[model samples]
Target: MIELGLPWVLATLPLPILAWRFLPRAKERRAGALRVPFFDEMIGSVRAGVLGRVKRFGAIAAMIGAWSAMVVAAAQPSWVGEPQSIPTQGRDLMLALDLSGSMAQQDFAVNDRPIDRLSIVKAVAKRFVEDREGDRLGLILFGSRAYLQTPLTTDRETVGQMLDEAELGLAGKETAIGDAIGLAVKRLGERTAEERVLVLLSDGASNAGVMDPIRAAEFARQAGIRIYTIGIGADTRAFGGLGLMSLGGGDSLDEETLRRVAETTGGNYFRATSTEGLIEVYRRIDELEPSEGRESHVRPMRALFHFPLGAAFVLSAMLVMAHVAGALGWNWTAGRGR
Candidate 1:
């Protein structure tokens, strides 16, 4: 369906009628050297017939057509409703993952089968990342040191690739939980304070980095960045016959430090002994740092100007053809020389 942007412009359509009714008409006069003074003889005697009346109305129709075209142009007809806006604002999140040797422990279960803690972390983190659509996400991998594996980006595929290729102890074999938090804080500080968030997932305490966990959390707090900490492993457990058959024992997660880090930054701490629990923990964090924003007002619209434009073009075309056929008695060359 055709549409016009400024329908109010159509109110000017009857302008020509108003001009005809109220405007003073100019007296028409003719001057010539070899011409007769009889108006009937020169202008053609009045002929009352169907064709005569039709020819008289032809000028009116052509004028109407031309005026209609002008009206359509003034109305600014357009193909409206082609453009649209979508809900767009989202939070900026930095994900810091621990890559220490203890992350290799196969104490975590997926589908009732034992999987390494890092493996579960990867799987659950991928899901969590997928859930954060429209949000800018960053990744940090840490062990003895910390490294920015992926800078803040909206591209989920690249972040996923970085997570997949991440090896245990990519930074080293010791957990630098504090350094990871510090790195996250540093990166998130560059973004909007209200939307900046740091999510740190680790199975061990900080023991190999220059920054302590509490100090890093303080820095994050000062920057108005929230830090959500997840302690990702269970305490040591032993069986009689197993004789400590590698229950993934000895490695421990510093929940107190993690909780303090979260509290200091007005974030939360979660524990995940199993893979399912890890998925739930991330979901809870998602709830805390929601992708929220206020929506702006959009102007409502309607279009209705194409009718006059189309009518004008069709009428103008008919007028040209009619004048060519002498239907309106218009003669450009005949009226020019004299």
Candidate 2:
């Protein structure tokens, strides 16, 4: 729909009339009458009195039209487009994934084929990101140090692509769980306290980095960042005829520290031993932290002042050309009669 931004400006449309009626006019100078023998000839030379009056009326009409166009332009007419839905508030979620050498373990399977831990994570996390339409998501890939793979943004496709391109041991071979949480807290601290969230997934303990896991968790808690820790990998596996053997012997998996980090920030700890379990863990997190409910809208606007302004210029030009043509025609006729 078309609208006027400065509708009050239209009130000035009668300003010229008001000034003409109330303002004092210049005094007309009086001259002594001089007797001239050719005064009758001079009067007869300008016999197009009716044509002169018509030209004067045409000039007034042109002036009025130009003034009207200028007034319309000053009113600031614009076209407003349809409203579009936009998210006013949504969760700011940061995902911190372990990129230590242990992430190469082929414990998870897809289509009955063994896949590495990172591969499984990339696949499942991509789906999770796609589902989070309104929320802003970020990625932090950590090994011995934590670094931002992607900043908090609504571009989920790029974030997913960044995760997929992550290589194992990109940040070094040892896990830096504390550093990951610290980085997440730093990034999410700028956002609202209620919507800040960090989901950290690691199959190893914090054997590297300057920050301690418990201390970092405390920092995150103080910063109002909810941390969800997931300890991935199978705990036990049975051999052909032997009893169950614990697969949690290596320094790779650390459930205690992960649990403490989650508990400190008032979030739940999840364990994913298989591909299905990993999917379920993300699904549960999605349920826990929902996207914003309230909706906002904005309408696009296009200015239309130029159209009226251009018309005013064209009308004024036409009036000037007409006056010049009439003056030239009168000169030609006088020259012919002479």
* Candidate 1 structure, TM-score to reference: 0.60
Per-residue CA lDDT of model 1 for 162-268, tens digit only, reads 99999986899998988898888888988863678889888787899999999999999999888888887654663112111123434576778988998999988
10 residues in a row with least lDDT, candidate 2: 238-247
In model 1, where do residues sit more than 4 Å from their true spots? 1-83, 235-251, 292-338
Q: How would you encode candidate 2's per-residue C-alpha lDDT over 213-247 as one tens digit per residue? A: 99999999999889998888755562111101223
TM, every model: 0.60, 0.59
Specify the highest-lDDT model's number.
Answer: 2
- The weakest ten consecutive residues by lDDT in model 1 span 238-247
RMSD of each: 11.3, 12.6
Give Cα-based local distance difference scores for all models. 0.77, 0.84
